[model samples]
Target: VAGLPNNFVFAQTGTYTFTMVTDPNNQFAECNENNNTLVRHITVTNLPDMRILSQHIAPSKLNPEPGEPITMNVSYENIGQSNINQQMKLKLLIDNIPVDSVYPVNGLVTGGTTTVAIPASWSSSLVGIHVIRAIIDADDVVNEGNETNNEATRSFVVGSSANLFFNQFFASNNIPAPGDTIILTARIGNNGDLATEADVSFYYLNDQLDTLLIGTSAIAVPANDSITLTFPWKVINNSTVLAARITNASELEFTYDDNRATTLIGGPPQVTVVSAAACTGTDGGSMTAVVTGGKPPYTFSWSNNASSQTVNGAAGSYSVTVTDILNRTATASGVIADSNCCPPCTKAPKKPSLLISGMSSTGATNKFCPGDTIIVSVKIPDPTACSYSWTVPPGTVLLGGQGTDSIVLALDGNFAATSNIYASAINTCGTSAIGTGKLNRGAKPGTPGSITGIQDGLCDVSGVTYVIPTIGGLVYNWYFDTVNTATGAGIITSGQGTGMVTADFTSAWVKGVIHVTASNACGTSGARKMTNLKPAPGKPAGITGPSQVTAYQAGVQYSI
Candidate 1:
């Protein structure tokens, strides 16, 4: 063979010509002598060799949190024109001891290269820096071009989890009345490994259960520490409920329910006579004071000689007064007359109480699809003569019967995951309690954005780390381009399953797209880099030493 390795060995170091002949023993005859014999020039030297090219281990993160998984990858090649059919083992070692072994390489042919990756989990106790090693053909099963280049090692650090939570809330005055200002304070704690920034928000709801959005506050909280926030709320209604909520935290938390706290504040009180028996010719009359609003422990005083608000008197006139712990009082008086002269007289009727028994959807299975019409019918109060007003959700339109009890809503595509409707009835007396109905718009996910970061390393020597945008997702997948495969054939490696990745960018150095897909129970959203990979800056072309140098004695300064 012209270019094949010569297996024969010569005793002396010299150049020689070797001749080959067909049927040298004359056992067979050839048609022509010129074509039967072939001669080749040969040199007595070492044979071709096969070796391990290189190996690499990718640490998922520079400082990975405890319990996070890390991966190790090794790349090897057959440098010689010989196939490795012998049994060879690629062993993964920790501190030079084999921890895992990969099976025999059966058909590693010439110029062939392959990569082997192993995944390992980090324990909670695994802190500080640790070294990982990937050794190919560790037992020296097959002869190689270079025996010293079989193992590659890498180091990484693992830390604990960073968790932040809402701790407690305090109000300067819990029983603040309407038109009064109360200072509300909330506390946030970080029981985690690293420092983090927390996003905090405040909310308030009146006695009617109508929620109001207060402004949000952004604060920084160090690890294993806590901070308190304060907000001044001008009381608008009595019996108001206040809450402090924290969401979109920079650090991942083990639980989210503890991120909110609530407290209730008192308001002005209202008193009314719930029951009043009219005075008649045959019997006396009695009345009881019904009190609402304000704080509890109320007191009642009747205008009659009786100490209590409930009193019995002859057919003349009587009055009652009600008071609360806050000293707020209400008075009401009624006239009693003979039944023959007064024709069953009484006070005006009270407001009708509103209630929503049920809400239905026209779509399939009571679920509203995108662009579907949702019809909400409130419990209609009969001929009592009361007006109705509905609090519609954002982007909802009342089609008909707005002043009436029933209304229709045309659901638009921008409808959020949940839609709520509140109805309140009002008449001459007072406003009724709010009635509510709700509908679900199915599963949904928050919008995700893409980001990019360059890693420290050269194109040919070390891999570049891309800091993937971390969006809330049940699972994450990353895809990178190796060539012009931006659209069709570019996927070189993937299945990172994390928010960050370290890959060889040399293959797609100048032009590439890193596409990340985030998926959950709802669906998936794909994020792609807006532009090609940016080229790393080259090293400085020239360098020089310090121009001026001066030496000094003890206690004297030296300049360079």
Candidate 2:
């Protein structure tokens, strides 16, 4: 291998050995024969070999709108036997002028591959085909296997564009009244290569989308074209501002600052209350409210459950409110009457005029029975104006409702043939005139109460008189026990048909039971029973021997 070429290359990169024999022909003798040979081994390999595998433009091989950013990508691999230890620069160039740089293969190992990406924006003025290149180690700074294969190129066209924006916005009128209808219009511009659709939306400045939806209009415009959109708006009370915005465009846009606009809107509703009237005596006066500046059909509501524009009743303060269709409200309040306060009006209410209406059971005779209960009701021109009190005879017992419009009384034995009851109405002002009615106790006597005087027949059972007491105005029938009487039970005796009885009891020393019945105009009463009747104890038997023995009163005592 003498005189080898200067640019010699290894056919196959690997380790090689070179040997030199200093005394191969034995031209000189050496002390040791084994030390006559010299040998060296070296590895032969190519330089750091790198090659561009692919060049790409993002949205590859297609046209992009001017002013849009584009991405340039280059893939490269280290195909040599040596590894690269330094940072390698991958540069992106447009028309052979460096535009961007990136390190694609930093410390690349043998047989390694990597890709570098560069993003660059084109000016809107660019209108033709552009040459973009990606170069690996472009400055020959890296000793690669092949220097000629470091760069990659690609070409693409810059096309036109479409941008959507709001150009003009206006309203039909700046000032609107409550409940007025108005129109709003917006103009949109499309500055691009194709037709596209966009949303033109309307808004009330301070209202939410759900509460005040002015509505949205969709419009399609040709490239480099403009369109007008119109919408209807109803003017509401207290509205101050309106706005329009363009949104949801179907294509890429050049700018967004001009897509929205706002305008001033004026006019609001107003409300007021007018007058309230005073009250007079027991009657209530009215109050009114006046509504001026708001949408109508106006409505009225009063605090007293009255739906009319005016309110009335009872002396006191009153209030009323009026509302318009737009929901604007006003209120007013005042005293109905100067002197009338609630509860006990300033001037005391007039006393009730009372009259005796009738009794519970009054007929042509105006009569009632003993022991009967009757209700006496009184009449008053104004029942609620005052309280009532009823007065009955001294012996009459008032059972219930003594001091009310009516009263109940029990007719006891105290009631005579004729009696009178009185009633009167009373209030804070004064007592009403007296009212009276007469009540006649009828002839129906109650059951016989008791027999007052009774005695055993000391003289004889015959001609004995018994006095029986019973309710007045009624007759009685007496009954006697048959064992004591010679006649049958219930036989009317000498006192028959009267409250007294005289009978003869022939059965000696026997108990007698007596009964009596009272009858009147109403009917006969239940019989009353009386027991424990006996003839006087039989005359003691005459004592004979005992009478003969006598002793002197002062000095002697004798026992027989």
**Top candidate when judged by lDDT against the true structure:** 2
Please give each candidate's TM-score: 0.26, 0.23
Q: Stretches of candidate 1 above 4 Å error?
A: 1-159, 267-274, 277-289, 294-560
- Worst 10-residue lDDT window, candidate 1: 340-349
Q: In model 2, which runs have C-alpha deviations exceeding 4 angstroms?
A: 1-158, 207-211, 267-560
Model 1: per-residue Cα lDDT over 93-146, one tens digit each: 755655677776553676777776654443335665566777777666554445
Q: How high a TM-score does candidate 2 get? A: 0.23
Model 2: per-residue Cα lDDT over 82-149, one tens digit each: 55546667777777777887754574678787766565544434765677777777655665546777
**In model 2, what lDDT does residue 376 have?**
73
Per-candidate local distance difference test: 0.58, 0.62
Clashing pairs in 2: 48-145, 49-145, 161-192, 162-192, 278-336, 278-337, 279-336, 279-337, 284-313
Q: State the local distance difference test value for candidate 2.
A: 0.62
